[model samples]
Target: MNSSEIIPSLEQSLITTDRDCIQLGSEEVATILVNLKSEEGEIIEEGGADVLIYAEGIEISETEDNKDGSYRAFISGAREINEARVGFRLDGKPSTKLITIRVQERCPEPFIDFERTQLIAEPPEILNDGKDYSTLLLQLYDREGRLLDDKTPVSLMANSGILSSTVFDAEQRLFTAFFRSRRVGEVGVYVSVRNVRYPVTIGEVRVVDPEPPEEEFSIIPYESHTMLQSSSLYLQAAGSPGIDSTKGIHLRWMLRGALGELHLPKGNLAEPNQTFNRSEDYVKIYRAKYSKVSFTLNLNRERPAVIDHANRLWIYRKEETREIYLYFRNAAKYDSLISNMSADINHSNFIALYHPELLEFECKDDLFLKLV
Candidate 1:
């Protein structure tokens, strides 16, 4: 075919629109439709043609294919006073015709989606350790249910806690921040949109001091021989603050065995007759004591070999005293460590003692028993 019969002229093509102009920040979007025709006024239905809508301060969706010779495009005014330029070109040809649409100035109706906008804490609660924290989330949207523009300024402030930052998420659709506190008090979080509107209260979170630990301790006999006064035992102790804490606490274990001289590690106590062990370190979040404590017991004499049933071991803690009797007669026959024993027995004339009951009730004991 000749060039005039093959190509369509831009002047002969028909351009139509649903509206002459679009109102900025309006919920209603504008649509534009274009139809191309050959020199003889015949509709050109050939595919692979270059058709596009270019605009400044406007958001455009992908051009929709009309199957016939016409195409449809959607445009939304993004700036108060801007314009959009619509054009089309056949394959391997430059754009021949251009259409301009005016954008009318308007104010957007912005509101917070209270259902979607929320403040959540990772742990729901925190300690005054200066290390624990909670995550803060906030989201804002316009009347059209679209996220506010990234350029929309925001202000986030915490009354009593530490705020990591007031920045938005990577996608710039949500605001994420971290809150922490070193003092025991309540934190009130507030947020502002565009820096001119009234602040929105996120909610309150509490920062509390670590709960004092309910310290527990006990003594257990590992092995013993009735013929010889020599015996071995394990001193186990454990306790933890309910929450995390930087200010460490103290746990002490003291002993008093009158029937025989104690043969064990040096004592930290002032009294010579009372040997003691102690732990003074901070406790981490959701964990037991900072250290595991277990000590061994052995009889010490100027000379070895002596049996006694009145042998006693005592524990001094929290200004309270507890005692246990160690018998040399049934040390081998009544193996307390192997049999079922009450865990709360602070005083017993036997060989071993376990607290909070035995973990391994069968022949296979726990690692703590194996270590003993």
Candidate 2:
């Protein structure tokens, strides 16, 4: 790595595209520019060894803009261009020389919409049959979420393909296969997803049988009971426009069996909903709320995980909605604080809501079962 003095120059930039031209949405070339000006308001024109420029998948367009009075060259096509510097000796030199600028063709468009994303199945439930081991046909998209390609592949796997598996398309999203129980028992499955457009994993999916992993537990009283199995509950979060990262009732719970899946309202999460930059205000990506939901499932220990926090366990119908709210908050350890908590329903799964902004512990308002 040789260090040298960078030449200061103006309009002596580099804007190169892998393709002289690219198909709309087709990620291909790059374009770059480097303009260095001195106090004289003149672009430095001296090229130096210390200053070098390079690029990938970027293009330099000739579209002149009347609005800015500069030839129109956007971070073309929404691809991100890394901001770089032209090194100068600065060894008491009256002026520094200039180098070149490298524009890039990196895709800046979010290929997957966090909100419009959906995990789909081919023949519905993907039941196992004969020599065939079900496959999930997937499709990916941009923020608008129009299918990027129609024939994306999704896979499934488990402990030796006996429990669960992973699915990946060119976009690299995952969906686990919950094989129809050969005989109806407790089955465990895990799912993780990815895509080229995403720097990290996009989503995760977890599946458990109609029964919670068996273990030891205690019980609480719900007075004057009628319809033991007639009551159920759910938690929902809204993903829409103009949702405040802070304030008011953002979530709703349902008494599934109580009133046949009717939603009841709840407040927002604790403060500090999301992060912000010095120039930009706070922006919210997701949020929601929850109320206690319960059910009953007969169990006798055909599983594991002895319930450690039964009173903290619950069950809810699975669905997405907007009328309700559920936001997220971050901690020092770098984990998310979803809504209040979950509780035990019956022999089935446990439930919790993600009211991202609030912490049940921080809120003054009591979190209780107030009939909606």
Candidate 3:
């Protein structure tokens, strides 16, 4: 036969050995069979031909010749889904008998769990004055009891009040709805997702009279005591005036000793204790001696006059009466050294030395002195 006649005489047919469609997530095999024939309808049994299969124009499988004029290729549905086209070639010829295979989702329906849904109205009540607002949180779950990941459209309807705005957070898988009402009554809310409507009774919000604000008070001690020359004093005050609290009462303490005038905020006074330290010359002499220390606790907001005294000494005495003596050597060096000390009184009243000779000091909750 001439080359033209021989090429035209060779024919190929492709057929699927399995179903035309595959179900997703199912481990089913799809097989294609290729047959080669002569013009006189005789099977070409002598094999050595290449056949390939493609899905969505991407090659997925290649055929193995059976040495009997028939070749086969297979694909697993579990690994691939969607529509695929199958084509076969014989002896380097162009592909023919192209067929399409389909892959479909196995589940026929999508559902959600209504019983697991949640609706919460923050503050539960809003003032009837119209300016105050309240927020509502809505949590939704799928039938598998998992948070819905997709942005499913949801609608909200109120029986009496109006929903001002709504926001959905995909990361938290919840929706926040802001609403307000000027009338004093109960506002019922209904929700709908994916065309499924829920009853208004799911969540109820109340609009009522605004309650009066309550008074609050607190006394916070200065974090640390400042050590100037020899005096260690800490300052404590009633609630942060004007900054944190609208109303605050200031207190002061009067010290009657060589340490000079020490102003302290009123709280409580624990007995002073003494300690001996031989490591530093500044505190070595006063070891184990109680320097005359006395204070009258008074609550008054009068700003004390700045007193600058020389050759004065101050001591910090804890509840156990452990004394930490501080004395000044050089103004610059003493200020630098004491600035690194800090103390925390744990909500207890502390006395701070306010002297022109001493700089500022702070104390932390855990009683430790660091100069700042």
Best by TM-score: 1
lDDT at 89, model 3: 56
* lDDT by residue (tens digit), candidate 2, 127-229: 2221223344334445775654424322322211122223344455434343332222222222222211122323322222233222211122353232232
TM-score (all chains, Cα) for each model: 0.31, 0.18, 0.28
The superposed Cα distance between candidate 1 and the true structure at residue 111, in angstroms, equals: 4.0
Candidates in order have lDDT scores of 0.50, 0.30, 0.50
Task: For candidate 2, give the lDDT of residue 70.
Answer: 15
Q: Which stretches of candidate 1 lie over 4 Å from their true place?
A: 1-110, 171-173, 216-372
Mind giving the per-residue lDDT tens digits that candidate 1 earns over 171-207? 7467776777766877777655543223356676788
Model 2 alpha-carbon drift over 4 Å, by segment:
1-107, 120-139, 151-205, 209-372
